[model samples]
Target: MRILRTDIQILRAIAVLSVLVFHFDLPGLQKGFLGVDIFFVISGYLMSRVIIDEMDAGRFSPAAFYFRRARRLLPAAMAMFAVVTAVVPFALTMGALHDYVQQLLGALAFGANLVLWAQSGYFDGQATLKPLLHTWSLALEEQYYFVLPLALALIGRRWRAAGLVGLLVASLLACQWWLRRDPSGAFYLLPTRAWELLLGSVCALPGLSARLPHREGRSSIGFDSGWLWLPIMAWCLLRGVDSVHPRTDALLVCLSTAGLILQPSAMLQSTRPWMRPLQWIGDVSYSLYLVHWPLIALAKNIWLQKVPDTVLWALLGLSFVLAQLSYQHVEQRYRNLPTPRALLRQMVWLLVPLLLAMGALALHMHMHNHSQAGGVAQGQQPVYGFDARCDQEGDFEPLPACMNTPRPHTMVWGDSYAMHLIPALQASPPDGGVIQATRSACGPSLDMARQSPQDPPDRGQRCIQFNRSVLAYLRQHPEIDVVVLSGRWQYYLDDPVVDARGRFIHPGQHEIAASFARVVQQLKAMHKRVVLVSPPVLLGPDVDLGLCGQRAAQGLLTVMRTLQTHCAFERSLWETRQAKVNAMLTDAGQLADIDMIALDAFNCDDRHCVTVMDGVPLYRDFGHFSQDGARLLGLRMKLGQKLRASAR
Candidate 1:
């Protein structure tokens, strides 16, 4: 609460540096994201202390509290947004700009986390292109600030601390549960992240603070001893958790930060000569955090054009200068201005209209371009276009092309991944000649009905009906030669069999395999050729592309590269799953007297799976390939060669 305790400032510097180095793609810093958790803990503690102090003094004002927060956070954020939005169009490709613009709007609306969560499910190489990607944390913090104060206000002081503690514990437990069950959701959403802030909040309790030894000149050894535990624990955490379990590791970082905060000693507080630079950076940290990522991204692009290290260094220096200017001229100016509550009131009054105008401008630009491109009519073939009569929720819907033409090829598909394969099919027609396509979240298997029973009742019914219709279409269209089915297989593999309360009732692994076998056997009886494309090897579930790009700019292996090399240990793990699924397919193939094309080996080699080849990113995120990567793989399939063959 003071002008940053020397220890706290040192930690802030460490937190920002860890993230920066991690962004720079330094080896062995995979857990750099833990830095954000540290920040959250710090924020929680500081904010709670401020609020409690003010309330105890009988001067707590929600409007004043919020005003300070806005003055501190919004101006710099808005400035960054405006600058990035203006520059991105000129620097990025139109397609990249379109996505960046959408993200920008989301960041402005304080919903960047939602935008990012939706984007996280798919693989998109362009994710790093958005400058505001880091704003998700700011958004999360803002969202927490809004709720924490109101909850305290409602409960009154007597019950507030207990209520806050209860909420923190509950949230942390929920986050841990979700981390194991659904790490992707846990990583992207705010609820799971609330615990880190809450951890700090717990540390801020007056009783806890009072318990600390505040006596000056006592032997600081005990306090300094806390630092030893922190790094050791931090090291263990960084080494232990991979992308699949980020939130789980986040807990460790939060705990480490809390420990460090609680114990402030001369040894820990003393700024080591080497650490001074880091502390200075930490002083300018907010600005450093803002500009570093974008500069790194731009540097990487420029470096690819053969810019030397000296030039890159110069660019970094330039970025630092700009950041200093922005902090001095923009952030400090706005943050230091005394709040005229009346002016604040007027700004709040204008906020909605201003935001609406921005949103309208963005929408107009998007629609204008879309209309120029002839919207959905000009070769924009919608395989799964909204049809009132069609079962939208169904696992499979026979495309109009397949329905009217009586195509000899039967394709099973869902979502963008399936759409990616279409170009490959058109380029190199399969042996069966005719091509049939179906796309939905629900795959071709009957298991879709069981796995997603939580879908809207109508949608669930429609999904089942759609699969039935596909089977009927197979029956009617006897010429359908080959059955090529593809969906995100990994998603189905780890399907949550238990509800949030931990009750288990859904189908297990054996049941899922049996259901899949049933579908394969039924299709085989129709004498259709079957090909099962295994899910592509992911970069990692927690692979932050923006972070990756930032790291790449720092002359380090991007997260993808690090995972590619480090994941040798994980191959055996992956191979076990692959073997189980392949064995199921093999048995089904044998039973049904059909050919089962195994494509798993095509994506991997003797040691590791290739995520990027020929300068093309293989994955859009953790699982699915980008369109470019998909197209390349598809071309290899058409040529009857494995990816390894072309690599050599």
Candidate 2:
């Protein structure tokens, strides 16, 4: 007989609720993300038990296992995707709509992890807008389900524990090693996460958890009470969240969850009225989890501003109602089908139409996008850089557009900050135009490479090599008499750096400032005039750069207050943040004859630094200028006349 464990239901409730709260940005449970870790452990334990028992019974079938999973997970998920697809054109921006289409396809293929891995940006702070972002976990779990059975079958029951143990150690060790280097890879991939599942697999190894004391087997009633604290304690320890992820905190949380799983149900299954609500929440947790994020994402997308706490409360209540309806209707309806054939027929009937509808919608949107962008030339990025492909991260050969009259006398160099300057440079065309030599993330440093949290261990070497390549280009091109340097200077100042000689380069303006000075001196030795463009103003993560201008332009009546959108900020705040960097730049300027451009001085006024001009957004994102923005700034700041004079 199948045992109906109320404890599993309760644990499910906690896991799903924590995830919901974390998504909603509720107070107190800051590390509610640990709930997903707990779920992984529980899922591994149950699946392992089923695979082992069925294999021993000689009835294990991959098709049957997959069909059962499909019946359990797919119906409500596809329905949500259908509705979200319908909502896409109305609520999201052009870029977001494009991303939505890509994500929708990834979700259908159960490859959201791979898509998101590729799309992972500089900061990864835009989680609220991506409605399907939570599906990465689902993708990882499905991949595990596909692989685990094969590995277990190969090893057989006799060596099950030994096999799981070996795999667990390998995965855990890899996770720890990669966390410091390629964080997103360690985070979103199956290999690193297999250990958490294997932990549960180890628990289900027949004789392992069987030796542990259960609630029903306990001598004293008080001993069973300690198990209750396990879940609570796990939630508390998860406060560090991803900072301590795939490490000790994760292990402890999984162990606590396993203990709760191993504990007998009799103590918690008592006819206690209070426990009914939690158990019910747990029963509907899967449905609730599927429905919550899209609701939150929809409000953020359409409103184009920060959602107030009051609206969030309403959304929370609405989420539960929607989840209950979905659970009662979609989840139960699909689950109650009499046979696999009946379930397959139901899946085809329900899924095919919705899938077709989403596909059609995506096609319409793609055609519309092509029409919108058809005016641009065939081989162009259309905005940030005239010929951005000339950069080190790109083709490394200057296109006609990247230079003036194809015989360039000026060189543009740095990181993405330099790319953002392309239009601004083009707007203020220098004498003989500009030749570009920029790299992404790899700043214009002589001997050291700046390291971000996302970079691999060898990223330092690659960056150093890229800088050397830039130097080689500069050496070969004696006609490039002027060099323009720009980058997100504060990023390099804030993050750690490594030198070409494999030495640790301390992160701060001191080392980077000195490095820039050396670069300037070397350029000056080549008789090239150097222009250093300082950091631009940033509105930080809280301000949605893409949405800020749109909201301001629409002049929407916000739920919070009249001036709800902050399209601009006080210059003082920016000045204060960049003081050290500005000081470093000043010191570097004194070392050689150079032109220093304070971007804030060009873009900001006495009171404010604005991101929008003439009702159009200048910035594509938080700090990178849109094409329109660069052009406007180029003209407004009189960059053309200034560059021409500076070249002389």
Candidate 3:
């Protein structure tokens, strides 16, 4: 109804800045994700106000409203999409480019959130490589736009206020429930995000706005009471806890923002000298938001070859310049053009860019696919395979040749990370030694576990069956001399312990020690040499080798070193868990009379765990070793000598 207010502009700046700092890996900005919630609320309030005003005057036009939205959202999005599509082929590996192309198509179709949700559920590292990872917000907003108008039309004038409020509350509750059950899905999908916008929708209703007092001076609330809400909001932003439960924190931020919007006081207003630039940035906020991320990613990549802080700042400055110019020349001109005719022109303009983007994305995918096919033909490395049993059971089966062949002199088996070690194993094969393996998504343990928190009862049955099949395979493979067991083990250490029925047991009480000990005992009875490989040190929960390389190039040596040190220190948790399991193994080993190889010292020194050893990353992610890292580790352990001698 009104052009953007100074306060609203100020809020926009806050939102964008929070996100920028978060993306830059600045401390205390981890909660910057809340900025998307702020944007959703603002979008709801503004769009609802316009729709209500137009509908009351009997001049509402869905076609015109949607056209305006498309013009506002699609052009810059397609621009970013086009740029990313063109650059990805040259910048990313073939496997990475294929994933990016899929993400691009999903973003273009406004279903990026769903694609991301499904991908996240699969436990793949592909999520980190997606350039359009931010499109989940746009998808949520588009989904809201699709439903909100028809909802307003149906309720009519008399009952609309109560109906809308009721719907908003119901949706909010539903989202809360769903988040607790399937947080990964809730985090990325549209339905779980609808309530945040609806809260803003309810606030925009005519009578609701009128009910609040329009005081000339600030309402008589004291300084303590007035300022308390700020820290309460800030605390929610700073605290980083496990998001296992439904997020009540988002609602807290949303409600606090609603309060600030409804009753702006002197304190809430931005009058400080510093606030001016942020406010200015807020003015062209939409363009700034669209352009910043891809630029940052590109800068990170280009400078990764040889980075300096000056270069980073220069790239940031370049991005700002490009954003401002785009805002002034492109966005401003189109947004202010006359209606209907402007709408038609905007549609044509938007469609051309989208089509071009789609074309570029397709080309990128084609090249990537061809590259991967060639790599496979040349026997570079195979990252994926199909298991016959997995196909029959409607699950990801074990690789067909993963474990069924005649037992080799040595065998390495576990997850994808372990699979990546195949190249290194092949490179340094012991004379007269043969190695075979089975690798899959689940950890090396054959214990029954759920794929997801929302997994049905059938999953338990499936896991039990799978474990039995694995046990039988192991029983039949007695000739496999050295069983090198490895996996992304750290992921399992903190998992909630459960009983056979999958009911949670008390913390620090449920034990898997005996079960693990028995598996070791079984292997020992078969006269298989057991080498329990420990997890590598991790820098963070998720790892991006490209990002790490960029940081290293930038001469952020302290940061990189600290990350490696922290990861090495954190590996003690795994060691502690291993101590308990190993004690059990020690007792079992005495009775079975077998040798247990401990390889924890392979990647660690007294005070640090080095991610880069001899100029190679020890890990692809936080805990799993990269191919190069694994090879280096294998070499350090004298794997070839030990395996060949054991076979003899």
Candidate 4:
């Protein structure tokens, strides 16, 4: 019986390609992470087939099923882990090394997804530092495999479909509810993801699979013929780079895969010419998925410089070759072991080497840590001045602490960048104490979120409400004189939302100009003085200034060489990316008839922007200033003089 369909292989290819494209950050593949959802569905179907068929024949064992899953998936995973552990000393920072060891322990225990969910932000920069991050999905699948046989045995063959459907509904509800409460947990944990697997299992039920249409003749054309394109088209239209996962979009991805499984026709599946390559890729998809991410991550760390397109392509090609080798030698050899006992024995043998490698890496990290412990700075702390009790997020309601203060007539308004500037205000207060009405990610513009659909629904709506509230506050408080605006202005400029015609929509030159005009007009009408703070000197997203400080303890000359050569942002990046932003801010200030404080005057020179000032790190991360940096900036700029003048 040809139980494994060619169409299924094609789907696997699509899933792997989507994931690869997403990780590689290729254009037009924003929602490629949905590939993991597709894999979950496929896994559910395949496992259900084996369990249900065994139940029909009256032969099924949970232990035997688990052994089979281990034989099939573990060898390649352990091999990848061994390779990663060997390279960790050279490729990762000390902090990253400690974190990776923990992730390693989690992966070996089949609890990586849980460990990752608890520790790291899925989309944060830290995620890219861990080579084992992709293991979370494997961990989820392994956990599912652990429970499937037992679940099927309890339900029995005749009642399996009904039981699976009920369970699917429950998981779906749990996923939706948890998604709203804790999206990361819902995304990485198995409970919220179980419905996707069960959805596939529903399609695999004996009666259902038999009933599904499998025509070999003709394929349908146009939207009228089939709804396959509908879900995919909807995904493309709705999803963006910044969109959160496992929401309604996840449901759409799962449903689309289910729809395709039920009807595998030539029309929907690619034509014969494309099928061969896709099938080959599908055959090696498991290995490809395992190797590609770690390779990319390791390369980034090892090079410590911009990887050219040629190098990236070469590395990608190397991943494929390695995947082919692992698939041929390790996966195929162990997968064909004679008995469950034999598979378990082989897994144990493979795991010994991996465990030894991890032990060695841990020892190295421990020694490295102990050696540096004496010199490590004990009291250094990163600065974040925003407190929920005082500075606002999402809404502009004045807190008690902010109200009736000495300088209540002066306001500091912007996002998290604005919040960081609070230390400066506190260090030197103007005539009237500053009233802070700042929210993270909520800028000073009106209705900008409507044009930028990239913001989550809640955040976008909150931004709308918050900006309107700011206007309301100004109208109500005529006594307030100065309104200072600050934010990471380049954020909107660099990530401009585009329309169907490839035209910049949100923060388009005209749209931003208009938005700024409205904001300035509103402030001016209230007879308030507007003060525009220029965008801060930005470092590349990959740079971590604090981490650099830790690395530079050896000597100044060594550190300076690395700093000038490897640690700085490209000169062109500053010249070009910030140019448009500066022009807009300058134009906005002119229209508002306000004074503009250019931050780069103190932070940058003609050649390159400084990352550190007088042996103290200027930035805590890529963008935000540390406490010392903010205080230094305040003193240098004489911001008290500027605000005091606004009070006049």
Candidate 5:
């Protein structure tokens, strides 16, 4: 029976394409990362088949298995790494380059997952710029390879299948539990990810394979099965990108993939004319995955620019050209080279890392020393003034810093937007100093998490707990009279909630309005004053205000803004974006004890909202205040006077 499965190759094409589309930010293709999970399943299927067949023949060798893996994987990876290391200095800030060094080293050592988990989240915007960010899955798979062969060897012939099942169940349950606690860990680490791989491994067992397909070249249940399976796979890939994976969505993808593997159709055959394109993509899949992200990342880093459709398409084209070359020159050659050429290639691989490391170190040190101000050092990511104690993710319980003052009359409560207000409040304190009860993305609204379209869904659920914590504080503290509610309210309005069935549901305007009104009335019952900070003038979602401001400082912002498709929002777009929440807040302010504060009144003109005023960058990326901007706005608005006033 030939092991070069056409079905597996086609699956590889689908998976890699999903990832490419996702990274490219092509509209309606958000769930492209599901490709990685599919890859893990494919790897497990093939690896299990190899180890099991070898063990059956009494010829299983761990060294040989690993050698095959390295030959297949490392040549393209090392080539990509060398090119990326060269791009690092020119493309990244010292702050980013510091993390890049670790990422590069982690790729070299096959531990990128651990390094990535400790630094940032997979869904985080910053992660897209790191060229080796994609390597985490590769590292994870290699780690699995190390353990799987030995694990099967130890389990013995009769019990091996049972052992694998036990592992799959345990790992999956652990993954589900851990996602609520540490989603980054659940995502990047092997413990939570093993189940998906184990699922395929179990399928590859002799008893299971016998029940599955019955033969090598043909499948028992063919054409109709492929039709049913392919659509399900596509649906899973497009469903919800923010659903924490190895979760329900990924399980669906994996199940669909497994179904196809066990019951592939005639169309999957390489001999079919239409299947040729998929076959070619699959053949170059490894190299495509290796090269695609770095090209996009480098372009972004080089210009600190967002990907326009033209740029995204351009990068995709370049990635294909480079991927084809890498596949031909390196991937195909390294494995089958003559002994002399193989030895020379090994020496080159060994020598390249040292040279790359030395060069990266020199550049990193030079940049770190000299990059005191400006350039891509400041990008679009949010910047906050307060320590992490008050504003955090996960559980709502906070440290001492959360309560800004021991006995405070005023309370600033909301999401990161509320956190930005801290500096302003500090600049002008109310009679009873403020106590903060805020969580990241957990707005002070009674319900409805401030879910970002791109952020993981668990944050929205945790946002419920965070809001309750704000209420609990209000109940315990009778002295606090003023309650300031704030957030990027547009997020909750625009960001759809992912329901139980993996469906995206927009909580209707009435539901959101009721939530704010309910919270306002509840505070009124407690005899506390309510301040609803109107969503401020925004520079649209794509503009990095700080970066834009930096360019403005150099008199280049006008030119920069003209080039950007989404960076600057016209007054019309801005008003429409905020119209719903603005209506609700206006009505809320008319109530007995509620007051609404609109910062845009002072910041915006008839034409547009100003990003920088008096040479201070008013807002951070998208729409949070930079530290100085908050203080400036506070002083300009005379916020302390309004906040300290007794009940209206």
Candidate 6:
């Protein structure tokens, strides 16, 4: 009744291997994420073929289709989830456990994609820490399955082609629009992704393959363009791991995959000896995909360093072996039950119970973390800024400084760095209360063209509008003086260097200086006193002290901290890394006649720059201060005295 294509199996192998290689950090497989796009196309084709064939035969059942999917996908997925849940208490810190619990809940409910979409940018530094992040693809596929059958049935035998074409066109358009506007939504949601799957469905249409001429050397079905597909794969690989993304950029890969499936030639179908291993991996690919990421995450969490090649190879071997075991035992064992009713019963008995248990565990961990956090005094919470605008970046809304300020006098402006200064400014308000006009990545730099890729999309535009509004507010009220400018100035200098005169210099230090100059000039034109605050000393991996402190302070799941040592690095390391940016800031201050405040000058010694001082951790993470750390910094810097003098 059903014909299995060896070529399709080969493609499956290719897809899985690419993904594995990418996740394993194998060099040159940067575009290995294209494997997922390949999978989407394959899924679309295979599911459509099966559904269409059944419908034509007058034997199709939507209930039976979904039952088959649940049986095939859920068993292995749930098993992997169970293992992750068990590993959490042992491997994850309480804070991490709380976060993972939320992800786990999302995974179980077929909403992991949505959860990840909302949590943070997919390419964020924290993405590697999430074991369930790979599940977003699975969630996306499952959501597709939910609606496909009904849509196909509604199209009927007569209009299936037209309907699928319309669907594909609409979805592709939506994906293009959304990718530019809201990349995360386009990436994770089914509506934007439906077209890729439907492309495969289009390939499976009854007479689609009849059009391609058969070639003798390239097997029975002779569409021999094997070399053509290479360029497509190469284009995808060129994108690399950091740049792996979807939408229009993914169209080429998806179309190529569809072309391969639709026109399988001898070039594609040859079952050579070297290809056997790939076919084998293909057989167990789903299982491998499920198990590999969590293993990598667990290893990273424990080691807290880059995994060595030797260990990575060993992990790869282990993942393959485990995948074989899972494929044979769990996936195959449960994939075929006696009947639909029996399968449903097993799903209810086994799958439902597992999901419920994980959900409950996640809920319990989340509540425990919240309760522990509740015990700390509210004032001790880290302050970035009091204004709602400070936390969120958006279009400007004019508001009086007195809205959040007890006495509106000084204003803090910059990026997230400015937010950290809020504590000190609040501790010692200016003649009027200190107000904050800040965005997370919105530096005070007037140059809108130099926005960071790490920043939110439209950040450049938002920064421009925000700066314009702030300048307008300053002009409107001469009462608000003493503008304290603070941000991670070093961040902007992370690009290719240019010279002081804006000439192309090697790793140039001048752009940051120029940016600072522009910002200071604008504020100075308004006759506002500009105070430049130096960035806090940045640290390495040891800076994730909050999680360590949480474990030590609150023994969640019996995690005990034996030592009082804080995360710190040598003063030399800090000076070496920050010297250029520091020089730029100091120069900017001198040229602009602005008062520059150096926190590092007081906090660091020649020996080592401690992350903690007198039992209070100076940093919550790598750069930002914790609430207690901020309070202590305010006192140590004598920010109140400085602000009072500056105001005078």
User: Backbone clashes in each candidate structure, one number apiece?
Assistant: 11, 1, 1, 2, 1, 12
When 2 and 5 are scored with lDDT, the better candidate is: 5
Clashes of 1: 11
lDDT of 5 by residue, 1-648 (tens): 126777788889999999998888887766888999899888888889889988988998887777777777887888888777776665554445667788888888999999999887421345665777889999999999999999998998889889999999999999988876677788899999999898889878986763433224546653446778788888888885345666888888888888777776555664768878899999999999999988877666544557567878988999999999999988887766545456466749646775766586666656555543333233333444356667666556535666666687788878777887888877776676777777776666655665453455466666776677678778877898888888766666676654323345577666666677888888888888777787677645655555455444333323243323323446766677667877766655665346677878757778666766776556555567767677777788777776656334
TM-score for every candidate vs. truth? Answer: 0.64, 0.82, 0.70, 0.74, 0.81, 0.87
Candidates' lDDT values, in order?
A: 0.57, 0.71, 0.58, 0.69, 0.72, 0.70
Q: What is the lDDT of residue 324 in candidate 2?
A: 93
RMSD of 3: 7.4
Error of 4 at 181 (Å): 7.8
Q: What is the lDDT of candidate 6?
A: 0.70
- Per-model root-mean-square deviation over C-alphas: 10.1, 4.7, 7.4, 6.5, 4.9, 4.6
Model 3 stretches with alpha carbons more than 4 Å out: 1-3, 126-128, 210-228, 240-246, 270-274, 299-315, 340-385, 388-484, 491-515, 522-648
Evaluate model 1: give its lDDT.
Answer: 0.57
Q: Model 6 compared with the native: what TM-score? A: 0.87
Off by over 4 Å in 2: 1-3, 123-125, 211-238, 241-244, 263-271, 302-305, 352-360, 363-408, 423-433, 445-454, 457-477, 492-515, 550-593, 598-616, 631-641
By lDDT rank, best first, the candidates go 5, 2, 6, 4, 3, 1
Ranking by TM-score: 6, 2, 5, 4, 3, 1
Better of 3 and 5 by lDDT: 5
lDDT of 4 at 575: 62
Consecutive 10-residue window with the lowest summed lDDT within model 6: 556-565
- Lowest summed lDDT across 10 adjacent residues in model 5 is found at 557-566
| Superposed Cα RMSD, model 4 | 6.5
Highest-TM-score candidate: 6
lDDT of 4 by residue, 106-187 (tens): 9989999988887743113346656888999999988888887788778977788889999999999998787665677888
